[model samples]
Target: MGCATGIVKYLVFIANLLFALAGLALVIIGILIKFNVSDATRVLPSDFGLAPILCIIIGAIVFITAFLGCCGAVRESTCMLTTYAIILLTIFIVQVAIGVYAFLQIKDQNSFYSALKTNMEKTFDQMDRNPEANETMHVIERVLKCCGVTGPEDYQTPKVPLSCCRNIEVQCPSPNNDVNSDGCAIKLQGEIEKNSKIIGGVAIGIAVIEVLGAIVALCLASSIRNSYRRHTYA
Candidate 1:
């Protein structure tokens, strides 16, 4: 019993310690997103503007709450552990709610993609005029192997960029040739959905950890109390 109790205590401590670090990483990521996104909000459409702000909020909450959880585990305090459990549960619920709301609100993918396509076409045009200025867009086009947001036709002059061609040395796709007809919007949407799923999975895993931490804390607290009671009676 003594060894088992000790093992539980250490396990909780190590788990919470790791969680504290994860929380800090999240906070840093959130801050970076806020700074980076703030600069691009002017150019980007309004629909995705709030994502960065939400990241910042969620990150800050995770950092603070995770710190508390770490402290509760280290000190073996029942009250603090309980408080940490409640806070984590609340955050988990909020995360799930936000995801569901976003999914429900953005029902029509095509319209959103259309607006994004317009934006991409403008960026491509800018890149054509001055490659250095729109270097990022050029890189994305090349990396994604996509010509435009919707299709190559989205190019104003009915010409495909060299980035969209399978072999730059051979020939670039033109208005008449539909070699690289894949739309970047679809690829971008797929990447976003994939990343969201990853984030959701990680969140669910951490929530499970949080539940275990709370249960262990409560059980350890009870064990400690019982030990004390036995000593007092003896």
Candidate 2:
């Protein structure tokens, strides 16, 4: 039983080390994406963007907590293992709550579509007022292959934006016949939902793994305590 417990401790340590590495990678990727988004939205309010930052923060927390678990498992320390288990359990609960909230929020397509359209119109207004915002919109349109909120007709211009041209070289001379009729809002919404589902699924999966880690930590801690008690009595 003692040998088995020792092997479990090593397994926990290895598993946590891998998790720590994964978390670190996630944090780095999140930070990079956050910087890109921040730069693109430089004219927008700091408070207006938070998703990437939140992702970075969460990844950092996961890394820190998993590293702690790894250290606890290596040292076979009761206090450290207890702390590790508690933190993992808390994180798992928070992840589950966030997943549920995201699921609920995304379930209503009509409300989301309406809200997104309104937001896009507001963004269009902002782009008109700010040159930097206009540049950002062009970048978005080119990347997303979308013209305006609903379609190119939404823009009150004689010609569609060059970024909206299907043939890249042939900037549409007129919106009436040249521009693609697809709305950016629908494409943007689809992408947002798809990414959200992927993230939520990953979080839920990690949370389940965290729960298992916590249970293993607690069991190993108990086993170590019993071993200590037996050696003391002998």
Candidate 3:
């Protein structure tokens, strides 16, 4: 029994240590993504912009929970272990719910694409009148290596925006041969799809880890309780 409890204790400690690292990783990833996608966030749905903030919040919670679990394991406290188990389970459920919500939101590719196109068109049309819009469009185009919503033809004038040029430093030729041929909508959609897969993969991985940690915590708590009862009765 002592051997088994010792193994479980060490396991819990290791698991919580991993949890701490994962939490820190999440915070860093969230901050990086927030900055990296700042420009694209302007054109995306408002809810989409909240993703990084959510990550940071979740990460902080996980880090705190991990600390609790580590303390409980090292001290062999049944109460703390049980509390840690409950928190882990709660976090697991919430993560699953959020994942489902995100999946459903993006399931309808057609609607998402249509909405993106509409937003891009609106932003493009307002470029001349809205300085912010103009700057945003230019940044999007330059970074994404894309042209107007559909193509250079979307522009009323024969010459495309300087941002559409493959090389911003050089002058944009009249023939527009040096411009990117891809549409911003298509490029943006592709980027979202690619990033969504990565996010989904990470979420699934974290969920698995949470479930395992919760199970281990509950088991350890039960063992501690049983040992205490045995000692008391003996």
Candidate 4:
């Protein structure tokens, strides 16, 4: 069983190393995409339905896996190590699935635009009804002013919606629509949202998994590399 255990450990080690690489790559890409989004550059379609919060969460997971892999390396317990590798890989698979879902969700651009128009009409209707709601319309106009866009599907126009204006320092418009524009901004908003979500998100997710896998593999390659170092180095 020592030979079998060693083999398992080696396999687990290889897996972990791959995952580590993948995770680190993912972390970098995720950070980049996140930064771009912060600049108010819409990269993903709004209809993708994945929130920016979700992107951060995934990036955070890739980073967390880094610590987990390191812990396994120091522990020298193949069982504990393999557990981490599996999780890293699992998340990569899940991320791929999310990408597919996002693609399908936004594929029908016309439908998405229709939804945006309907929502805009609904919001303006409420705004028109109440005297106090007048400010909401101007708020929306401001978003149009900033984004330099007009109308729901008006991506070519030169006016950003006023509603997109916000006090938040990060990501001008929250992934959540409650804070931003009424129609013009919100309607075209989702277009860049999904790409932003998947580009770094999927990239990092895959990279993290691959790196951890490689790391684990390397750990097994040098099975006895640290047998003595474990005690003396400690």
Each prediction's RMSD over C-alphas, in Å, is 3.6, 2.6, 2.7, 10.9
Instruction: Please report how far candidate 3 places residue 182 from its true position, in Å.
Output: 1.8
- Candidate 1 clashes: the total is 0
> How do the residues 167-207 of candidate 1 rate in per-residue lDDT, one tens digit apiece?
65665647645346777767766665567678778767876
Question: What lDDT tens digits, residue by residue, belong to model 3 across residues 179-200?
Answer: 8888899899888888899989
Task: Output the number of the lDDT-best candidate.
Answer: 3
Better of 2 and 4 by TM-score: 2
Worst 10 residues of 4 by lDDT: 39-48
lDDT of 1 at 38: 56
* Residue pairs in candidate 3 whose N, alpha carbon or C atoms collide under 3 angstroms: none
- Taking all chains together, the TM-score of candidate 4 against the true structure is 0.47
Question: TM-score for all predictions?
Answer: 0.77, 0.88, 0.85, 0.47
Best-fitting candidate, measured by TM-score? 2
Error of 1 at 40 (Å): 6.9
**For candidate 2, lDDT tens digit of each residue in 38-85?**
656442223336667777888899899889988898888888899999
Quote the RMSD, in angstroms, for model 4: 10.9
Q: Candidates' lDDT values, in order?
A: 0.68, 0.79, 0.86, 0.52
Better of 2 and 4 by lDDT: 2
